[model samples]
Target: MSISNTTNFTNPSDFILLGIPGLETAHVWISIPFCAMYAIALLGNSAILFIVKKEPSLHEPMYYFLCMLAVTDLVLSTSVVPKALSIFWFNSRQIDFSACLTQMFFLHCFSVVEYGIFVAMAFDRYVAICHPLRHSTVLTNLVVAKIGLAVMLRSGVLVLPCVLLAQQWPYCRTNVIPHSYCEHMAVVNLACADTRASSYYGLSLIILVTAMDMVLIAVSYTQILRVIYSLPTKDARLKTFETCGSHIAVILIFYIPALFSFFTHRFGRNVPLHIHILMANVNLLVPPMLNPIIYGVRTRQIRDRLLRLITHRDT
Candidate 1:
């Protein structure tokens, strides 16, 4: 059956994404790879969390931030992957308005929190590398807990209004979302009502929250670089830079495509839908999938622990 027939949406469900065209043609073929990726994301992120929680030696502010990142990755993958798989495999792409809104809300919420956590991680790295003697005192357990709470609250405050505003609009067209998941702009674009205000508000939030967080992260890393440069020994400088390399790589991986996707969707729709879809998937999936591997390989403790766990499990 056609999407319109299945959805029976007359009023234009503001949030029901129909997924991109051409997916229906390759549904069966795509399902295998998509499901495999989702399985890996779920299992991989969950294992990260389990390892961090079970290992007492990892009970520190740095690992705490890593745990938070793992949780965010799991939530992000969970929020988008299953529904996407269902759409591809079962030919059940019709998401209700409320469900779509809920998905969009959680997606944005976790995305914002992910950025906040990245900033926090940068700060942690800065302290550890630049002020090693004072790192413990500066980033105590209490302080880390407060920071995590603050990140959640900040994300909620920034994204809640945007989701509410987008939902209030009247959808006047087909409810089929052209992508696999319910993204904020995709939903807003479907509205028959004037979306200028909502668009502006969402853009403003993106600029304020994302831009500011990136600035703070940049400043922290700058200071870190200066300290690393001033070290007397080349080995000390190399070790310090090594500690931050994975974080820098992850940051670029996470932000560049996201910003590009956002801009392309908003300003470059003239670009092919396929390009947009590709970029969007990269922004959503690649970072989460790579984060664990990057951190696991770079951080000796996590690497050793992961190895030990795997070895013990195999034995």
Candidate 2:
């Protein structure tokens, strides 16, 4: 909570990103795992995109939404990690105000979009499982495309006000952001102006968006479970559950870390600053790194296609 003099508030040109301040000495070592995760995320998600595009059998709504998720994970990681690694490996810690705002915008936008995709996927599963006869008509390719576009536009529109709000503030305080990335609230806290509106807006959206999506997902799954139990055999029940395993795993990975990080940042009085910073970074990193692996392992089509693709390349 370092505050600077108000006299320096004359529209500062750039802000300094204090990347993991407590671990500055070990930043290079830290960059090793971070870079590795980024690389794996990039490669893994790319493989998903490629396989889904090449396989005509995967031209369904579920895989299309999965492809959207992969793209989001790719962009989300790219938004946060390169700059973080730069701070770690090259000591490139300074970012222009505009650049920081842009980073924050994309970081939050893609994140919102990612959650939207999860909701879309959950809806896809609900339709597929609970209404198998009408699933095709209900979630046609055109409908899926529209849903994907809507998710993108919805997130883009919602997250814009956040960055625009940041732009209005005068950064008279120490331009040093305590976290690795330029999150909206972190940047807002540096402003000399009243930030009640921005703070309220950000928190309200998080609660609203996350709660709405979680509630819808819960309803979808509840209906799905009711449908599953009506099946005549245990094998049929297990098979039905297997189809949802990847989505469940991904939802847990995505929401649990994100919600925990959000809570700790906003309310964890006893939590250390470094822990907050680390969770912020973790929320950004882990899902992208693990999502493709989860899908590849749990979803038979993706696993088979990936293995065949690799085997063909090897041969």
Candidate 3:
């Protein structure tokens, strides 16, 4: 609430994040689990990076893609969670104007990158299961690196416009953002200028990216399932299915809550403000925390290597 107002109107005002509105009394208690989840997300993703690097046998296209995913999760979570904790724990809720835009840029950029990684992982599985013979040749190290670079570049390029547009708008309106983080639409809404173009552009990005990635992932898995069923024996089918379980689980974890939050924020008029804001923050954090657990539990090589590292086994 410490806003500086001079008769000068050219300078952009700082944004006041209300954290989770209507739950102000419980902010300290609420931050406990938030802090725990952020800790787990950092440690889990770091462990994925460590294990994938240390184990030579783990150096395959699949594991390399996983390392990329771990890195993205680290960047995404680190950008938002600390700021959220500051608001919840210390009630430090003011964010600078340029800093807010930077936060929004990284939030959406890494989010898009994460979705792109899911698509790549799906393709990796499809190549392995559908075209087992050509798996190595089809997804060479060079190809994987290219895919990672393309995803990152695409995310950055596409998200830049949104931040730039937001910056140019005259902030003739209030500068209070109710959400924990500077979500794109929420910040853009505070502008007094006509923002219909910005609003639709943001929605288009969400729909287009989410829909395109979902379709690609679905097609890849469809081919994978067909190949599995065509295998000679039930045991073979089950084994192949096991290979995909982690990817499927991770996809579900990442997408479901995310879509829900996005949709409710746009359409669900009856939903409470606190729930809407809280879910948006939770969706981003929960996926990063759970992704490593899902992979470590489902991917046998990683689990075994993790156990070995824990036990310090030489043999």
Candidate 4:
């Protein structure tokens, strides 16, 4: 075959995922835990939704924000894990260009939405603690609905250009993506054409959306702490901290690994490629798996409802 003909086979219409480097012999073994995590995430988030729906008391702004978070986690997890499972169990790693782009879009869209939701939740906590009297007036259902809608729209609009630009580019190079699922930059780097615009856009999107949201969340918590410290008693301080425990756990779970993975990809050139890929997958998986658990355990309302749910179901 000619060199051009040889290149054609490597540049397939569908891309194959490198499930995990240095562990090809153990893909099935690796898949078991991932499968469990995905199952738990799905069930746990669904239960959160169900409990929030069935319990009329949970119809308030806090649960409303949580419901949004649960939905975002569900979408985000579903977008990636199924494909990863396929790659692991069935060795079916070929993903069409359109399918890959679709996955990338949802993965990023929900990710951004979830970040926005975190900021929304931070604001919810802020109002609940700092301005308790006006919390109801400020975060009416209409307002929460508007916030939810705005977050979703903002994520969708911001991520669309990345997809459009990617679609316009011709992938003349090898189509093997070095991660188990379609990630934004991994796929972007595969394009043989000039990708400076896409690179800049992705970086800017991360900064504008995720980084900005993190800063806002931090500021919200700072104000919340100030309010808590101003309270007269140690009991008051403890109560305030207790109220924020679940959100704090979730914020740490969601951001720490994500930011680490982001920085690794950008600056950790000495880091192993597999480490980068593993952390990326972990960042996606850990939050969904842990969020429901954290909320169920730490948030009294959710824990009480969950216990009541289990007891009633058993009876």
Candidate 5:
């Protein structure tokens, strides 16, 4: 194969990213808010993780999943937000090919893991609500550990090949990505060679993974609702619904924006760049920021524990 056709960047003259238009003029303004967001996301998620770890009452499977979710959020935000803030602040938009690929890998990996965690959390709720008699058997400590491992393994293995395939594509001329983070589609679009295979593979994977998880979660919640309705006491039904209300809100917040962004990017090319960028960042940032808040507020036990911890620390 010709040197030009090869994916390997043997020389520095490989790819040039045409960064977002008008970045020089808008960098400073965007930087301020972006930096603030990063600070809040890091501090917020870290605080949740610390609270969950230090509190013995939070040793249950639900809180265990929340801890995992917090960790994933921290990883996700740490991977993308700092780089984004740097670009906004210093106008240093250049990212090495290997570094870009690594970013894409981790971003996708953690995103997949986050989806898996949502599924697991949904299952936890289902078991607790629908099968209270067997909740312990269904979601034991060992089972939670195994599920966590499966989430990591499933996402890691499934996304690794896609990242490798992406890195194999020759990026000849354009390397600039529009958004702050290394989105897979955006990165693939930079390749000089045909990216039809990579695009199709990615779409297939997204559809398969996301659709399956959504179906499972939906089914789990359906059974949970059924069980809730079967309860003879109105208070019992109301309490059960209250327990799941926050999670359902979180599910909508997390999935709706992501699905919109993904579909618009894939099929709705006519959408404006600013709109796309806005939706993409919202998908990444909002969920991380909202998740901990939702759990802390909706679950009285967690809220009470968080309050106690704060009060104790202050004392």
Candidate 6:
């Protein structure tokens, strides 16, 4: 998805997704776990939304950010998994050029938005732990609304250009994408025109915004940890550390696979194609699936409510 200096442009063809490339034969089997992961993601995130709405005491900045994360995760997973399952389970591979661009947009958009939620959640922890006295005054409903709006706007603004560029690229080269979804790089590789613009746009957006958010998150957590350890009693320190541990776990789950997939896509020439693709899929699917589970297990409020709901079969 890129540009050409010439006035000539050829209409793009409908792209054929080759679902896992060499592993096409096993796509049916692959669909099983993918379907399970999607199901779990749907159920887990929906439960987080449900439990938060039901418990009055859970109304706070942290849970508000958790709700944003849950909703973003739901969008992130749903954007790709079902279509991927169509490719895997039923041999449905033809995606219209417009649809391909659309998928590329939303998938990348919400994926980045999901990372933004992580940052917001991190900041929530920083405030709650480091400045406990002013947490409410600082992250009030209006400020939370602003932060959520900022995350959505930042993601939408940054991602829209790439999808637009994808549409301009002349797609006379080939239409078969050798992966499960319409990844930015995969789509760019299909353009007959020079694609340096698309590549640079994508890399710049990822490096600038993602790297900035990560650095801010790291700084916030560093401040949080410093405050946690300074508590006069060991019990105080342990309890505080336990609260932030799950957030740290969520961070690791989000970034590790994402960075690896990106690295393999650009520099891992020696790596197998399917492995890279699998890593990309993991970057999208695993975080959404695990974020809720991690929060439910770690946050006492969510955990208690979830357990009670399960035990009582609450309406």
**Model 2, span 99-160: residue lDDT tens:** 99999999999989988999999999999998889999999988999999999999999999
Positional deviation of residue 292's Cα in model 5 after best superposition, in angstroms: 0.5
Model 2, runs deviating above 4 Å:
1-7
lDDT of 6: 0.87
Candidate topping TM-score: 2
**TM-score attained by model 4:** 0.95
For all predictions, the C-alpha RMSD in Å is 2.2, 2.0, 1.9, 2.4, 3.5, 3.6
**Weakest ten-residue segment in model 1 by summed lDDT:** 5-14
- Give the poorly placed runs of model 5, Cα more than 4 Å off: 1-24
> What is the overall TM-score of model 1 with all chains considered together?
0.93
The superposed Cα distance between candidate 1 and the true structure at residue 223, in angstroms, equals 0.7
Score each candidate by Cα lDDT.
0.83, 0.90, 0.90, 0.88, 0.81, 0.87
lDDT of 4 by residue, 1-315 (tens): 111212544234677787887777888988888889989999999999999999998899999999999999999989999998888888887888789999999998998898899999999999999999999999999999999999999999999999888878877777778889888888888887889999899889987887688889999999999999998999989988899999988988998898899878878999998888878888888899999999988888888999998999999
Clashes of each: 6, 0, 0, 0, 4, 0
Give per-residue CA lDDT, model 1, range 283-311, as digits (tens): 77778888888888888988899899889
TM-score attained by model 3: 0.96
Off by over 4 Å in 1: 5-16
- lDDT tens readout by residue for model 3, 176-293: 7889999988888777789888888888998999999999999999999989999999999999999999989988998999899988988898999999998998998899999999
Model 4: clashing residue pairs? none
Model 4: lDDT equals 0.88
lDDT of 5 at 26: 77
The better candidate by lDDT, 2 or 5, is 2
Can you list the residue pairs that collide in candidate 3?
A: none
Overlapping backbone residue pairs in candidate 4 total: 0
State the TM-score for model 2: 0.97
Candidate 5 local distance difference test against the native: 0.81
Better of 1 and 4 by TM-score: 4
